[model samples]
Target: MASNTFERFDLESSQEWKPYIARFRQYMISQKCDQTLYTAHLITAVSNRVYKLMCTLCHPNKPENTEFEALVEIVANHFGPKGSVVAARYEFRKREQRLDENITGFIHQLQLLAQRCEFDDKLEENLRDQLAAGVASDAIRQSLFMEKNLNFTRAKEIALNMEAAANTCKIGKENTIDNKAKINTSSTKSARRSSSRCWRCGRIHDEEPDDCPYLQFKCNICTEKGHLAKMCPQSASKLTPYNTRKREGYVKKRYHTRFSNYFGSDSDSGSEQSEVQVIVRKKNKKRQLRYVKK
Candidate 1:
């Protein structure tokens, strides 16, 4: 591994001490750094403020005489695990990702917490369950649950692939919706342009001919083409016919009055005189018709 990987191991807070020391020890072993130089490497890897503070409190004697195990114990006592293993396990169980947290970062955090819990044969199973539980996507969780013989490595790979596919699908759907919106906007503009053209004269205007007085040529009264309501022939015909129906009603009323005069003009006799009035009115109507013709 690169030397820069150890940079993040610099302990800044008490919570980081456990994982930091564990990773540092692994790095030292892999690099085959001499056990005599462990203290020097530890001091170099930590932050300047922590190293200075440790030097003042821990190195009261000569720095070369300080035992490695004593220094490790002192650091562990101040910043290592404070509670029992059971409490650590409980915290690991409750570990979850926030809504805005990244999935891979959350899994890595769970793995770090699991190390402190000291899970053995059940470590991969526990990590898998926690990984699935803390994932923000339900699709990945369900996919993990459906697997028969899933281990941590395979589960992680599947989850990553599923997350990537979901992001791609979301982007595609958004692009499709944007394209549809553009198409609908263009279609609406075309419809508005078409509606502004007059159907009768084939001329374009700001409004349709039915609503625009300058563009409209049909008569409103007669509903005919090529004329306005002011010059409509049906307008004069409508005025002339208005009193015709009223005059007809007046003539019928006069005829009924003549029948009533000849019939005895009594309310009780109306039913008995109706038949005679009908016969006499019909004969008088025919004679009046002949006199009018002459």
Candidate 2:
């Protein structure tokens, strides 16, 4: 075979000897290339750097004269990386199905780890145990654990079938895969506005807003139109001295509030609710009075 026909081996690159030689062997078998050609094929396919190194290694005898099997064995022994058995086994044991990965992909990863681990006669048993213990789905793991005489092949079969069935069911039931968290907004939204704070005027309204003493309502809290200082959003977010301090110490607070509806249907009714009362207190503890209308 021509040198360019196969990938050139460069010691500087990440190219691995095992896979490179495996591919060459496969091509040779398919082409029915003679065993005699294998030695020449390997020598011809390597880069100049590798070839020069091989020449030095062969010394008095040329590399071409070197037996193909001996040449391959010599090069592999020189450059092929040695793997740690314990490390490989640790990785194999730690291998679990990833969130986005399927059972097949997970199993393929396990198989790769198994090759490096050298489980030998117990390879199947080890694979079976890892598959059962490390499957992503609790149902699949439980099923495998409960199965009688579960082998590697049987575990793989069960996992694939379960995965396919789950995917099919999900596809048929819209695209949603898992539940997401949400706020309990219904409980909060359904709550009614208390009679203490009026929307039109600032005070607690006994009934309708149209009867509010301050019909041209403007909130002092938010400086907004159509709402009272008591109904301001800015007023609602933080604890006001009104409710926080006054209501907290119901007995000690010298502050007193009178409702707009405190007066009867007598002539003082409209004048009474619309009465603007002033409170004298510390600037920090200051609170605006709210009037309730019809």
Candidate 3:
């Protein structure tokens, strides 16, 4: 095995002395180190200042001369007193999932906190209740509430699934909103282009329609000198909504003969005349009825 297994003791690190020492023992076990040399290894693992402090703690007796358990106890006492049982449990119970923490991290944090709490055989039960009670998501919490005979495994599974699904949905919704905003922006650009587009020649520029670049452009189809082929009134293939215009002329009011759809001057269709006008041609100058079919 390689020489370096465990890192040196770090008081400034987030890991407490107890957990650090526990991990050091596991490392020693993995290395198949002799139990008698554990105290010696522990002595070298600490920093210079820590080794001096340990020597002082040993007093007349040398650190290497002591038992492993005794040296550990001495070091632990020097570091800090054991925490209260009530305080540890209170801290464990109060721990809720933080806003930036994910489900896996939150559950791991709970497990760490539960170590100090002496729930014994009811550890799983306490964990389950605490997880359900203090979950960050209300949907997960409520699902746990409605769940029948919810255990730690079941509760954790449900909470994780719910959290994952909610996150995916939130991402999808944000992406959808972004896509809609982009489409709206594209449509706005298109509208601006159309607004500045010239109807006479289909050229786009920031100018009025009458001041278009094609003011003197000739029409290819109609041979018009002042308009393009698309804007030529004589073009038969130019039927479009823009080409259709409302006529403001009035139709001549006249009576149609009901004899055989002939245009005379009287009819039983109605007595009151509508505001209709029609152009008539003079033939014999006696007002001859001209029958026109639409």
Candidate 4:
């Protein structure tokens, strides 16, 4: 038995040890083995860890329930004295590949380890399951957002808050996301407020009159209309005191005299002619009076 064991080991020793060790390490890491093998010596020691997982998956007896440790034991049982680390790695990869596919199916099975774990409410539980299955947070949140009243942004906020709480019960510390959202809301409100246009000037402002220039008639003066006070034809023709004196109907009053004070300094040359006629009428009246007395 000792001769056979030595011969079997010698065969493995003939293979390039460093490359074999490197290849085996890659296999283990890719397979997601818990314990790492640093050297070829350690590979032989830790080789059983891989075979143990395979045994647990393949075996039916005593397979009531198996944790990571039970799987490790099964992997160790397979890495027996007859197999070399290099040969064992190839076989390990084959088994792990099948297990990887089954892992996806098993997660959805709802029978293996579902009831053992405590679940959050439906929302959180579904999110957790999706993340475990490598689904993105944004994708899940977007899907939830399609539901009634579940906006994407709001759902993301809830998820981020929940994660922050789970990490370290520190509420409101991760509120930077909320602060940006507030800035957006304020910006929208400002945009809405700025939409009002002024009544008099068609310019954007905080408020507009009910009778804005665009809606109501324009001022006649500014728009050159018939009835604006500044542009009224009646006002243009209305005379001032100076213009009234220049008109034909104006009769100038003497300083402190009546019509008998005909030779007034205020009269022009034509006014003097009217005074002479008045004197002639008085003379004619005197003649008539004298004849009556005779």
Candidate 3: segments with Cα more than 4 A from true spot: 1-79, 197-216, 219-294
Of 3 and 4, the candidate ahead on lDDT is 3
Q: How accurate is candidate 3 locally (lDDT)?
A: 0.77
Whole-model lDDT per candidate: 0.67, 0.75, 0.77, 0.40
For candidate 3, the per-residue lDDT at 196 reads 75
TM accuracy, model 3: 0.49
Off by over 4 Å in 4: 1-164, 167-204, 208-214, 221-294
lDDT of 2: 0.75
Residue 135 local lDDT, model 3: 86
> Candidate 2, which segments miss by more than 4 Å at Cα?
1-7, 10-15, 55-66, 99-101, 120-122, 163-294
Which has the greatest lDDT?
3
Q: Can you write out model 3's per-residue Cα lDDT over 1-294, one digit (the tens) per residue?
A: 425546888656566778888999899889988888888888888778777888899999988898999988998988877688799999999999999999899999999999878889999999999998788888899899999988999998999999999999999999999999999998887788667757778677765677777888878997877668876777634322222223444222344322332333554354332322233333432333344432
Quote each prediction's TM-score: 0.47, 0.49, 0.49, 0.18
Candidate 4 per-residue lDDT, tens place, 1-294, comes to 011111112122444433444555465566555552222223244335333444355567432244534443453445432335455433322332123333234234332233323332453454333333332335434544454665324544555554455446334546866888999998887787578645354456544444343444444544633233443455445422231122343333212112332545655544323311111123233311111100
